[model samples]
Structure formats: C-alpha cells, structure tokens
Target: MSAPEPAKKPNAAPPVTRPVFLARATYRQRRMRDAAALLPILGALLFALPLLWLGQNGGEARTSHVMIYVFAVWAGLVMLSAVITRILGIGAAPQSASDDAGAADTRRG
Candidate 1:
C-alpha cells in the first residue's frame, strides 16, 4: 500500500497582495516622452547631413572635418536629451492608492 501523505499546516498565512498602480502621463509628459522617442531619429538626420554634404563635395580634409562634426553633434544631442529628461523628472513615482483616492474625493465634491 502507498504511504499516507503528510498533514497540511492549518496556521499558514495566505499570500498578501498590494494594489498595483500604473503611472499615467500628463499631456506634457506625453509630449516629452514623444520627443525623447524621436531623439534617435533626429540624431540620425543630423548625422546624415554632414555625410551627405561631404559625399557631394569629395575632399579628404572636408571629409575628416564633417566626420568630427557629426560625432560632436550626435554626442551633444544625447547629452541635451539626458538633461531635458532629468530636469523634467520624467520617471517620477506613481501616486499611491490613498493619494489617488483623496484626489478623487476632492474632485467629486
């Protein structure tokens, strides 16, 4: 005959669950996020400009100059975007449930 299974503990606590909150962006936050999303595209366009100009002109010295400018501009744009996001506090924490409930109460009244 198979062995009997061990008895379960009756004092075990159930798993505790907290509410999950999502961060909803405001209009300005949305706009800033959109701008951040576009940074790479803008950087690519900026990088291409000098390359295109140098490709048409075809000078060894000009080619080097344009390459340097491209790198410098690309780096500058990355830094600028970092600064903008930092100043805007783009990743601020979401409001807590209590805070949200309080705001809703104030609005309804």
Candidate 2:
C-alpha cells in the first residue's frame, strides 16, 4: 500500500469556484438569432400593410392594383430574406471532408 500523503494545511487559501452552465451565444450570434426570429414577423407585417391601407381607403374595383401590390410586397420580402440570409451566411455550402479531399486532389494534379 502507498504511504498516506500529508494533509493540506488549514491556512492554505481555498480554490476558487466557478459556476457550471451551458454554452452561451456570442453577441453576433445573438443578433443573428434575433433577426432570424423577427424576419417572418416583419414579412407578415409587410404583407398586411398594403391590404390594410387599401381596405381602409375603400377603393372601388381596384382588384388589379391590390393584386399587383400584394404580389410585389411578397416578392420584395422574399428577395429581402434572401439578401439577409446571404449576408448572414445562412444556407451556404459547408466545408466538408469530401470537399477538402477534392480540393487537395486538384492541387496535386
């Protein structure tokens, strides 16, 4: 059996304690998350605003204008969402092992 170690001195300083917790979001990541959450709501509001205005004004037989406005709003929102996603690097191609291998092969040849 191993000899017993000497006990720690009572005068020694105690070890510092740290709190246990899961990983937290960084500032940029938190902002991206917030933006992602608000995007759909913003899109919905944009879609409804024109309709609400037209309904309030009570236009007579302007179905074509309403249809045009609705579709335009929808298309604009879709483009805006695409732009935001691209800016945030969302849905971009991931760098995988296969891609790295292909790149290495090309470099050799």
Candidate 3:
C-alpha cells in the first residue's frame, strides 16, 4: 500500500490571489457617487456665503479666513452625507423587522 502524505505545517501561509468580480455594480455606485459629488460644492457655497457676509459685517468674532474655509469644508461633508442618506432612502424602512425589534427591546419583563 502507498504511504499517506504527511500533513502540512499549521503556520503555512496561504497564497495571495486577486479577487475577480463576476459582475461589478460599478454603474450604480458611480451614479450615486456622482450625485453625491454635487452636494459638497453647493453646500460650500451655501455655508461660505453667509460666513463671508458675517465677516464683512464684522458680526463674526474669533474666526479667520482659514477658519471660514474649514467650516465650509465641514458643511460640505455634512451636506454630502445628508444627500447620500436621502438618496439611498436610509431611514425609509418599511414597518417590519425594525419595528419588531423595537417592540421586542422595549422594557420586556
């Protein structure tokens, strides 16, 4: 009878291989990203204009031009996140599992 093959070492590293996508969801993700990209520019304008006005009127205190830019960037990110959430209908779940979960978790004796 042929001898059995010895077991390999436990710490033997696995070979690395690149993943192949059967079908990429590229177009939808691209569309969502493109839609999301529009948000930041609009948000920056919306926030910066009011801040610039405040600066011009000497109403804004303790904020420099650089600070204005930072605030504008933050506002832009917030806008983009909001846009993505709304576009993806994140909070529009149907009355099902979430409701059941809430009911289950609510002060059950």
Angstrom error at residue 37, model 1: 0.7
- What is candidate 1's lDDT per residue for 1-109, written digit by digit as tens? 9999999889989899865843555656777878888888988898778645634456443767887897899789979898768867878767899999999999999
TM-score of each: 0.48, 0.52, 0.38
Q: Residues 1-109, candidate 3, lDDT per residue (tens digit)? A: 9999999999989999866753356656667778777776776576666445554456664457757777777876887788787766668868888899888889595
| Model 2 agreement with the true structure over 1-109: per-residue lDDT tens digits | 9999999898988989866753454556667777877988987887776555544366553677778978998898788777768767888899999999999999999
In model 2, the runs with Cα more than 4 Å from the true position are 1-26, 54-61, 100-109
| Top-TM-score structure, candidate number | 2
lDDT winner: 1
Model 1, which residues run further than 4 Å from truth? 1-25, 54-61, 88-109
lDDT of 1 at 98: 96
- Those runs of model 3 whose alpha carbons end farther than 4 Å from true positions after fitting are 1-30, 33-63, 97-106
Model 3 score (lDDT): 0.71
